[model samples]
Every structure is written in C-alpha cells, then in structure tokens.
Target: MKKEMYAFVVPCSARPLVFDESRCVGCNRCAEVCQVDILIPNPEKGRPPVVLYPGECYYCGSCVMACRQEGAIRLQHPLMNQAKFVPVRHAADAGEEKPLPAEKRRG
Candidate 1:
C-alpha cells in the first residue's frame, strides 16, 4: 500500500540576495556550493551568478565562503543572519481559536 503525503507552504523574504558583479569572476564556485541550488551561472564568460529561486535559499552563506574573490555574493542585511519560517495555515485550519492580543496574552 502507498502512504499518504502532505505539503506545506511558507513565506520568506522577497529580496533575499544580491550579486556583486565587480567581485564575481564567473568561476561558478558559488553556484556549485549552494545547498538550495538557487544560483545559476551564465553561459557567457565573466558574468555573475543568478539567483533562480531566492525564496528557497537557506541563507547559510556557503556561497559567500566558497567565493575566494571577496564580496561576490551577499545575502543582504535584515535577512543576513535572520531566517524566518512562517507556517501558512490552510482554509480548513481557519476555524481554530486565534491567539489573544499581546496585552491579554498569557506567558
């Protein structure tokens, strides 16, 4: 028998990354090391990597470390050291009791 499966949707930062063209050398190291496989290297030479799927990024800075060229890939401020996992509830879950306001909320 086949087992059941479920999927969850989550919200993440929109502008999660920025590639410094001046620092990148088209070596494709960053693309190779990314855990989420978001970075895509250009076919042409001397071009910076592209973030194909920014929302899936884990912001682990593996790309930054892999870059020996200095400041080639930056994960942006506010989201640099911060990673948010917002669980999106479906319509079926809307009937659940909502949390109380901060002033009335219990510890």
Candidate 2:
C-alpha cells in the first residue's frame, strides 16, 4: 500500500541538482531567468550550469526550459533512483500537465 499523503511525498529528504558538463552550451539562458528569485550563478565551467540555493529551488523547470542543448540541465532529486512514482489518483494530485514532475514520477 502507498504511504500517507506526504506534504513532501518525495523520497529523498534533500536532493541536489546535477548537471551534464558536456551537454551545456553556455547559453546562459538558465542564469538569466533565475536572476529574479530562482538560482545563483555557477562559477564552474561546463555544459551543466550551477546554482547557489539548490535546496531553496522551487523546481520551476525554468533552467530546463531555457536550455537549448540536448542534456544541459538535469534535476537529480534525492533517493530518485530508489523512489517509485505512483500515478496521481484524484484531482488534487494533478497539478500541472506539461511538466509533470519528471523526477518525482520516474519510478
């Protein structure tokens, strides 16, 4: 049986964002949108961008949205590989359709 409705049903207690250094095209698009209140500029040099407030991330998918490369930005949620995503049953579970929290749903 599935566990109780977790305000944070996510598996990992704390997960960090992982980047593909090679895939990053240095478009700086992710950095642009994140300037307001999303992320901090990563000084590292690579395809995958970096951030400051990783834990504070709202998972808005903006960085990924601005990504022009194939595999530039990737979200590596905590206990992701170990976690299994069960489809949302009721109307409450379904929030947005376009980006259905791929990391959370990846079983």
> Per-residue alpha-carbon lDDT of model 1 for 83-105, expressed as tens digits?
77787654336664546543422
lDDT of 2: 0.60
Off by over 4 Å in 2: 1-13, 35-38, 42-48, 80-107
Clash pairs detected, candidate 2: 21-47, 24-47
Alpha-carbon shift of residue 33 in model 1 (angstroms): 0.5
Error of 2 at 62 (Å): 1.4
Best by TM-score: 1
Task: Give TM per candidate.
Answer: 0.57, 0.50
lDDT of 2 by residue, 51-73 (tens): 54555666667777777886777
